[model samples]
Target: MSFGLVARAAGMFAVTNIDDILILALFFAQVRHRPRGVAIVVLGQYVGFAAILAAAVIGALGAGLLPESVLPYLGLLPMILGIRAGWKAWRERHDAADGDSPVGERSDVGILTVAAVTLANGGDNIGVYVPVFANSGTSAMVVYLVVFLALVAVWCAAGRFFATRPPVARALARWGHVLLPVVLIAIGMLILIEGGAFGL
Candidate 1:
């Protein structure tokens, strides 16, 4: 694989993976001060991404086995996730604020949970990844993997940077309870529309 080709592949991967920043940002906003909290989220992202990569690879190898229609239905995952998150936020808002527990004391961030959500959020990305993988040979795929893994670290750093900003952090904490799920649902809808799912 030429360096240029690998570079282009990296660019394409970044472009397709851009929307995930929002997902990561939201998750990062919920990070706790615990030693493993942020690490769990970061690791969860890789775990979830691995799942996506595996699916895309399979689709690429199988080529014709999966129907394109499956692509749009994946949107339902994020949509449902958004709906659930919205409900949770609403409930939390309605609950009495306990004086004993400071906000952010008890984190909702779970490694497996984050991984599951990431998987749902990324479900639609297979559409792009499958074709990219299919066109490339084994060597290019390896190059793509290297570029992708490195970029995932970069993405995590970016998310953490954004999350740690005092002003942005305050804003997200204040409004994210309401906004995050709406954004997630919108993402799901976009995926559906883009994939032509549900006759969109």
Candidate 2:
């Protein structure tokens, strides 16, 4: 039971970071320099994430979206995602030196762009969590939802705060950008290992 809960949480975290690309792009937009616009983007992310959670819950209640048998296989997705993230990080680092900004390097994107990017990324979260929630027993559903939503809220709040600051924001924009891919890869590999993909 505790193991299932942990598995679901891992799935949610793995999928959620897919939006970092969009968020990264938004930081380069001047809109991020303005508190109001940045807040809107953050709010948009919350709305998108909340919707995914609601959708997952509905899917879970309606039908078994994630059977216990499938949990192990689902765990392998993070490892694949992580590989892509690492690649993206390397690509961005190289591009930056050449004055070629990665997609997330723009800060001038409007509400529509931010919303679109966030929603698209949110779709990945839906795919991963919905199945896990569907297989989760009633005893664990609420716990999973609460943890997932809380994490989303915290992420948005912290993101907004950092988006509004300059020095901290710049440092994140510079150094943290590279770390994002590395973290994504690490999370993916961790999930795969937990899922027993390596048979260790």
Candidate 3:
């Protein structure tokens, strides 16, 4: 109930999810001209973020049942995802330069698809959220949940806002492909090192 607790929760959630705004901005740019686009994008974000929260809860609870070393290997998911994203970006960049027309557009923009991408893109969040949730008291956990859920809205709005701005969206489109993979890889490495994986 303390203001400090609320402030800490707000900061943690915002910082942890900062990268998502970049991803979300691209998503918003893709769908912005469509009818009710913002609503759909926001809904997708909520569903995807909720999935992450669910995974964090499971990890926190299962942490006690699993071997201590298991946590470190969890970092592999994000690393693998990062590699895949990097490869995709490389292909897209080459295609763009070659005038080969990058990959065909998807015929559908279902919430499920968005949710899956969000979850995969956010794979690194699991490592951070698990330990934090595991250590928190029930009251603090509740505060964190409420704060994170609320901030997801703010995140979506910011992403959408950025998408409406041409220069920002274009710059992100040009650079985000490169940056996303690097950020994910960095986060994954940080998690592994902090968890003492591979004896490093």
User: How many backbone clashes are present in model 3?
Assistant: 0
Q: Is candidate 2 or candidate 3 better by lDDT?
A: 3
Computed on alpha carbons, the lDDT of every model, listed in order, comes to 0.68, 0.57, 0.71
Off by over 4 Å in 1: 64-106, 166-200
Query: Rank order by TM-score, top first?
Result: 3, 1, 2
1 or 3, which is superior by TM-score? Answer: 3
What is the per-residue lDDT of model 2 for residues 1-200, given as tens digits with 9 covering 90 to 100? 58767666755564456345335334435465565865666666666666777776776565454454555555445445556656776776655445443334664655556556666666645545554555456777777777766776566666656655646655554665565555555555554555565574
Model 2, residue 47: distance off in Å is 2.3
Model 1: per-residue lDDT, tens digit, 1-200?
Answer: 68896787676556556546646766777874667777988999999888988898887778535575565565666577668768987888744233121323435778887778778867756655665565557788778778887888887887778665656544444565576567557656766787777677
- Judged by TM-score, which candidate is best? 3
Candidate 1, residue 72: how far the Cα is off, in Å: 20
Which sections of candidate 2 miss by over 4 Å? Answer: 1-39, 54-67, 96-113, 123-141, 175-178, 185-199
